[model samples]
Target: MNFEVVLTCAVTGAGDTTGRSKHVPVTPEEIARDAVEAARAGASVVHLHVRDPQTGKGSRDPALFRETVDRVRQSGVDVVINLTAGMGGDWTPAKDDWAMPGPGTDMIGPDERLAHVRDCLPEICSLDCGTLNFGNDDTIYISTPPILRRMAALVREWGVKPELEVFDLGHIRFAKAMLAEGLLADPPMFQLCLGIPWGADQTVETMAAMKAQLPPGASWAGFGISRMQMPMAAAAVALGGNVRVGLEDNLFLGRGVLATNAQLVEQAREIIERMGARVLSPQEARNRLHLRGADA
Candidate 1:
C-alpha cells in the first residue's frame, strides 16, 4: 500500500441535504468556518460549494464564492481550496412536455457554469467529465462532451488545475480522451465519485475498475457517499489513490450519529494512519495536485 495519502474535505455540496440535517453549512460564513475547522482537523484540501442563504439550496453565485474563499484565506489556515464548477447543470424535464426543461431546472452554458471559477480563481476547480442521470425522477445532470472540452480548455487557460470528476466508466473514458487531446495539464488530477443513485455504485470492484481506467501518471482520489465514505478512503489508498470525506457526502460518523466536517476529517486521518500511511499536508498536497499557491 502507498504510504502517502491526501485527504480532502468536501465542506458543503450543492445537494438538498441541508434540510435533512441541520449540521450542513448554509451561509458563506458558515461554510468558510466549517472549512477552517476541517483544515484544523487534518484535511489538506477543502472542496467548496456555496448555497443560497435563504433556501439552503445550491447556487453558482460568484459573490458567495468570493466571500467564502476570502474568509478561508484570511483564517491563516493552509488548506488548498477546491471550488466546484458543477452547479448550473441540473435539468428537470417539464411534465407537460418531456423534451422541455421544467421548473427547478438550473441549466446554463459551460462558460456560465465556470464563471465563478474564473472570478474566484481558486487553486482547483472541478470539471465534471460527463453527463449522467442525476437524482430521482426526471432530473438529468447535463454535461455534454463539447461542454466538457470547452470547460477543460478554459480551466487550463486560467492556470487552475481541473479536478476531473468521474461518476461512471464512460466519464473515465471521456476524461482519458480529454487528456489525450491535451486538454488537461501534466499529472492529470481526478476525483472518482461513487454511490450516488444512477451513477457508479459503491463497491471495491467498481472503485478498482475506475482507478484502472485513469490515464498514465495520474493523481487521483475517490469518494463514496454516506456509510461508504471511510471505507472508500481506505480502498482508495489501498489502490494507490487519495481519499475524500465530509458532511457533503455523509452526515453520520456511525449508526445514529451526526458528524461534522471536522469529525469526518479526523476519522479519515485516523484511518490513513492505521493503514500505515501518512496523510499529506496542505503544501504537499498542493504540489502533488499541481495547485497554485496563494501567491500564484
Candidate 2:
C-alpha cells in the first residue's frame, strides 16, 4: 500500500452545480479562498477550474484563471496548483448538420486550450488523453490525438507537469502511447477519473483494471463523482495510489449535507489517517512527484 498519500482538493470544477449547491465557488476570489482553505485543511494540491461569475457556467478565460491563481499565490499558501487544461473541447454536434457544432459546443484548437497554462505557468496542468461521450446523448468531449500531442508538448515546453486525465481504459492506452512518443516526461502523473456517465464506472473491478494498466513507476490519483467520492478515495488509498476530493466531484458531506471544500478535504484526511496512511504536505508531494516548486 502507498503509505504516504497526496490529497488534492478540486476547488471548483466545470460542472453545473452552482444552483444545486450554493457552496460551489463561482468568482475568482471565492475560488482562491476555497483553495487556500482546502490546503489548510490537509490538501497538498488544489485542482482548479474557473466558472463564469454571472452565469455560473464553465469558462476557459485566461484572465479569470490568472485572477484566481494570483489570489491563491498571494495568500501565502504553499499548496501545489493543478490547473485544468481540459476546457475548449466540448463538442455537441448540430441538429441539422453533424459537421457543424451546436449551441453547447466549445471546441477549440490546442493552443487556445493551454493559453492559461502558458499565462499562469502552474506547476501542473491536465491534458485529457482521449475523446469520449461526455454526458447525455449527442454530447461528446473531443480530445483528439493531434490535439493532445500538441497540448502535451506545450505543457512540457512551459516546464509544467501534465496530469493526464484518464476517464476510461482507452484514454489510458492513449496516455501510454503519448509517453512512448516522448510527449510526456518520465514517471508521468495520471488521474483515474471514474464514475462519470459514459465513462468508467465507480467499482473496484474498474478501478483495479485501470490501475493495473498504469505505466510502471507512474504517480497517479483517482476520484469518483457524486456519492462515490469518499468511497473511491478510500479505494485509491487502499490500492496504493493517491486521492482527490472536493466540491468538484461531490457536494454533500452526507445525505443531503452540503459540504465546503475545506470540509471535504478534512473528511478525506480523517479517512486517510484512520487507514494507517499519512497525508503528504505540499512540499513532500512535490518531492514525491519529482516537481520543483512553482517559483522554481
Candidate 3:
C-alpha cells in the first residue's frame, strides 16, 4: 500500500469531552487557536464543531460557527477546514411514556441540521450517512434514509464536499446507495468513525471490512475514539487509508498523560512517518479530496 497519508485533527467534537479533559477547546478563539496549533503540528485538515461559550456544551448555532471559522481563517494557516453538519440529530427517549422528547433530545430536520454549514460554507462538511443506537441509554441517533438523502442533496447543492461519515457497516452501505443515486459528487470522501458506543467496534478486522466496502476510487479516512486512536491510525495507514486524531477522540498522550490537539497530531505524524508514510500537506490534501481553496 502507498503511504501518502493525510492527517485530520478533529478540533472540538460535539461531545461532553470538554469536561473530561481540560485540553478540549471550548471557546471559539480557543478552538481556532487549537486548529492552528494542529496545523503547525502537521495536520493537513481540521474538523471543527463549535460549542456554546457560556455552557461549554455542543451547539448548532450558526453565529458560533461564524466566529470559529473566522478565527481559524484569520490565523492564516494552510489547514483545510471541515465543519460538522452532524449536529441537531441527537434523540433522547421520552420520559413521560415515550410520547415526547426527553431531557437531551435535540433532533431536527436535515435543513436545520445543515444550517451552519450552509451559512459558513467551509471547504468540507460532514454528512452522517446513517443512524444507530448512540451513547449509554435511551439515546438514538436519528439519521433515517430520507433525512440522509435530503442532507446529501443539500450538501451537493451548496458546493461543499460532503465527508460521508459512517459509524457502522450499514452506514457504509447507505453511503454507497447515495453515491449510486448521484447525490454525492465525484471522488466521494468518507470518514469511518470507530469505537463509538453501539457503533462499529474498533478492531483491525472491522476497519479492514469497512475500508473494503468503500466505493471504487473513493478517498477515505478513519478515526477511533479513546484508547483506539493510535492503533487505528496505524491500521488506517496499513490499509491504504488516511488517518485522523485529536482531543475530541482521545484525551491522553499516554496513560494519565493529558494531551492537547496539537500533541495528538504530532504523535499521529510521527506514527505515519515511522510506518514509511509521508504525511500530506494542506494543499496536497485539498487536491486529493477535491476541496475548495481558501479563497474559494
Q: Write the per-residue lDDT of candidate 1 for residues 1-296, one digit (tens) a residue.
A: 66888899999898889977878999999999999999999998999999999999989999999999999999998889999999988899899998998998998999999988999898899998888888778888999999999999999999999999999999989988988899989889999999988999999899999988888899999999998998999999999999999988999999889999999999999999999999989999887777776323
lDDT of each: 0.91, 0.94, 0.90
Q: Each prediction's TM-score against the native? A: 0.98, 0.98, 0.97
Summarize candidate 2's per-residue lDDT along 1-296 as a digit string, tens digits.
Answer: 77999999999999889999989999999999999999999999999999998999999999999999999999998899999999999988899999999989998999999999999999999888899888877989999999999999998988899999999999999999999999899989999999888899999789999999999999999999889999999999999999999999999999989999999999999999999999999999998997757224
Q: In candidate 1, how many Å is residue 73 off?
A: 0.6
Candidate with the greatest lDDT versus the true structure: 2
Q: Backbone clashes in each candidate structure, one number apiece?
A: 0, 0, 0
Residue pairs in collision within model 3: none
- Which sequence of candidate numbers ranks them by TM-score, best first? 2, 1, 3
- What is residue 241's positional error in candidate 2, in angstroms? 0.3
Candidate order, lDDT descending: 2, 1, 3
| Evaluation by lDDT, superior candidate among 2 and 3 | 2
| lDDT: worst 10-residue window of model 2 | 287-296
